[model samples]
Target: MTSLTSPTSGANRPARLGVQIAPQHAPYEKIRDTLTEVEALGADIAFNWDHFFPLSGDPDGLHFESWTMLAAWAEQTTTIQLGALVNCNSYRNADLQADMARTIDHISGGRFIFGTGAGWFERDYDEYGYEFGTPGSRLNALDDSLNRIEARWGKINPPPVHDIPVLIGGGGEKKTLRIVAQHADIWHSFGDPQVLEHKLGVLGEWCDKVGRDMSEIEISTELKTRTVEQADQLYDLGARLFTLGVSGPAYDLAPATDWLAWRDSKNA
Candidate 1:
């Protein structure tokens, strides 16, 4: 079995379940209630995405902010790990983010996963008045921000209770994959079995180039659009962490039970 320090150390382990309780088109009461149920449902992780507006349903839907809700969840839930599915590095300074994450880690007693990525949604930039820089430029900023974030983590008083695992979300081959090899404790991506296999090879190459152990990084993927059988295929290809993504308003978890059952069987 793998220790929490290296959650992805073993070639075989339980298929961990994660749910993104998308904070959009729903009241905080409903969102809060759903989060409680998320932990009770036995999901290994709970995530809320970072964005100003709803990505689905209505363009002007009721939506809560990400980090604030996370802080609340840190105080609310007892066990399920919480964080943004992918926090936008372009939205805030890395130093502030490091402090916020450290505080949440303490609040949750060390269950926060720092999942982050380069910002992609232009609407978020335009509406919030951030520069919609070129993709390459944004990637560069993310690369720089991670360094600052790590440096800040060291300097922050009352350091994080745990190692504060880093999860980098992206599939960009050149800059993003290299960053993952260097920094991520978990790498989340959206790809089918074939695509996942190909990306794993590319990631392995990046690990070789950087001289890091690929086995140390957990492989995470979304399960919102795939079937249990399809997820089994992904697992065969080295993806162990599966996230069932449900957008807000209802916070549907009925569909996730099947995946949870599958996870149980796989672990057994």
Candidate 2:
């Protein structure tokens, strides 16, 4: 695992907002329109979750694949960086994920963020016929796959248009944080300020052991139920990228609009 700091990580980076368009319980046209709308609303990143079924409401509601939609989103939006909020590593081969990301990177004119995770959803594996291994085994697999993914990116023909930024999601202290300290350009977590503060301390210890600078990994967190004031606590702790999750038929972006204004105010 490489310990070099990512070029994109910095304390001076402006606070940025991302929106995760849940691709469930709605038609693809609805999803497509939501993507464009968020970009026009000035979101810094547009994301979709990798799930085989709806996480809420109906169990068999209308749904779509993640990376495929990301490819479409790449062409649909001209500015917003596109990727799965957290692509399931168990769903695809590591090399294929890298190549697919590179292809989309080209298609989007270098606007891509490779956000991935060890994948915890059991249904996605059971329904898709992937091995529903133990969490430790899955995490170990993720650690190995990331190395291969990075290696594949180097050897692929024509090469990636840019050093595709890697955004990893999870808050596990033992393995996940180690992985982030080694490879991530952006580290996204779902913890509250108290949880994040403690976990980040662990991450710093891991970084010290691996000879990585914790500051070289941009801190990210979800704004699922957080107010700007609540988010301010995280911002004070160094989180620069905030993601809001909008789901289903309506895909309400009013909250995102407010957050975008907050982001602009922070940057200013």
Candidate 3:
């Protein structure tokens, strides 16, 4: 794990907004349009999930690959930071992933967030001809892969524009938090204030064990199941990045606009 914290993810940074435009159940044009509109609407980050099929919707619904879309997004957007909500490490080689991330970072001029985790989608592995290993095995593999990724980044040609902030998304107390403490510049997970507080305490212990300043990691959570008041509570509990999940079809911005307004108010 490289000590790759971004100035934008540090304690001094403001509460940032991220939107995950789920690349499912929609045409490429619609997804691209939604992404363009999301950046225009003042999102600090834009994310897509790394899944081979729709997690919801019609089982075999329209879906797109994550990394390829990210490459396109690097060329498409200007200011918004881009990444997968959580890329599954089992699907790609560790060093290859690092190279791809570095390339996208250059294309986006240093605005790529490397969000990743151990894979959980059994179907993704089964369908893609990958071995669906046990949970513990997958996590151990993720642990190894991240170290390789960070090391590879250091050796890349015309190196990454920045240190390349790492965002680890998961709430598993034992393995995941330890990894986040060791590697992540941003720790994203699902929790209410109380849950988040507990997890933060656990993560703090891990940080202490790893000789890291807990404050060095920004707290991130999805806003899908949380209200504005609840989000305010999460903020009080130290969550600074709020992400809203966006999908195809209409890809409406009513909720995103509301949250962005709330973010500005808090930042103000």
Candidate 4:
């Protein structure tokens, strides 16, 4: 297995900007439009959460499966990278997940980052007939699945165009962070600067124990607002990838642009 490390060179490294397009709230065309606008505006990656139904509102509200939408986004966008914010590992077999990711990697010409996690969101499992086990069991499943994913990738006839970057999202102090150290190319968490600072500290401890360099694991988080001023603190704390989520139809680009300018200025 390859070491999951962040790229070096802090100041010269280009900040990554991404956006999550909520698939539950909009039709396909609207989702496509939002993706196009995000790409046009210089977003580095595009993502959608994996869930069978609407997570926030009505149980029966419009929602789409993650992989299908990713395949479409891979085909539609010319430059922006694409993937699920975190695919539920328990929902599919590890080998199947590997194949699906490889297919999408090809579809996107190797831009797919396979973000995954132990399945959460009880409603998804209970309603969809998947077993909703304890968190430990789910994490165990994720660990095994990741092993199979990497093994299967090696066995495939035509391998993925590039080694698909594995992204794992969760802030679990023990199991999740351990898995991130062992497997993830990127670690994503949602929290304020102080919380993230603490988590990074813990993550660093884990990296030391695992013999992995903490700087090699790219830190990613979602931004509710676009201002780089707020993001500056996170960047200082080692978060170089900032993502802003926009729901569709009116797919607002203002916040995305604000962050893009910040990224360019930093690069400049």
Clashes of 4: 3
- lDDT for each of the candidates? 0.88, 0.89, 0.89, 0.84
* lDDT tens per residue, model 4, 134-171: 99999999999999999999999789999899999999
Question: What lDDT tens digits, residue by residue, belong to model 2 across residues 1-268?
Answer: 1222233334587899999999998999998989889999999999999999988889899999999888888888898898888999999999999999999999999999999999998998998999989989999999999999999999999689999999999988889999999999999988777777788888889899999987888899999999767788788777899999999989999999999989998898
The clash count for each model shown is 0, 0, 0, 3
Candidate 3 lDDT over residue span 1-268, tens digit each: 1222222223466899999999999999999999999999999999999999999889799999999999999999999999999899999999999999999999999999999999999999999999988988988999999999999988889799998999999988889999999999999979667777778888988988999988889989989978777887777777789999988777888899999999999889
Which ranges in model 3 have alpha carbons more than 4 Å from their true place? Answer: 1-11
Residue ranges of candidate 4 with Cα displaced over 4 Å? 1-12
Error of 4 at 251 (Å): 2.5
Report the lDDT tens digits of candidate 1 across residue range 1-268: 1111222343565689999998999899999999888899899999999999989899899998999999999999898999898999999998999999999999999999999999898999999999999999999999999999999999999999999999999999999999999999999988777677778888989999999998988899998778767787777767788998887777788888878988898888
Query: Once superposed on the true structure, which residue ranges of model 2 sit more than 4 Å away at CA?
Result: 1-10
- Global CA lDDT computed for model 1: 0.88
In model 4, what are the clashing residue pairs, if there are any?
A: 5-216, 6-216, 6-217
State the lDDT at 97 in candidate 1.
95
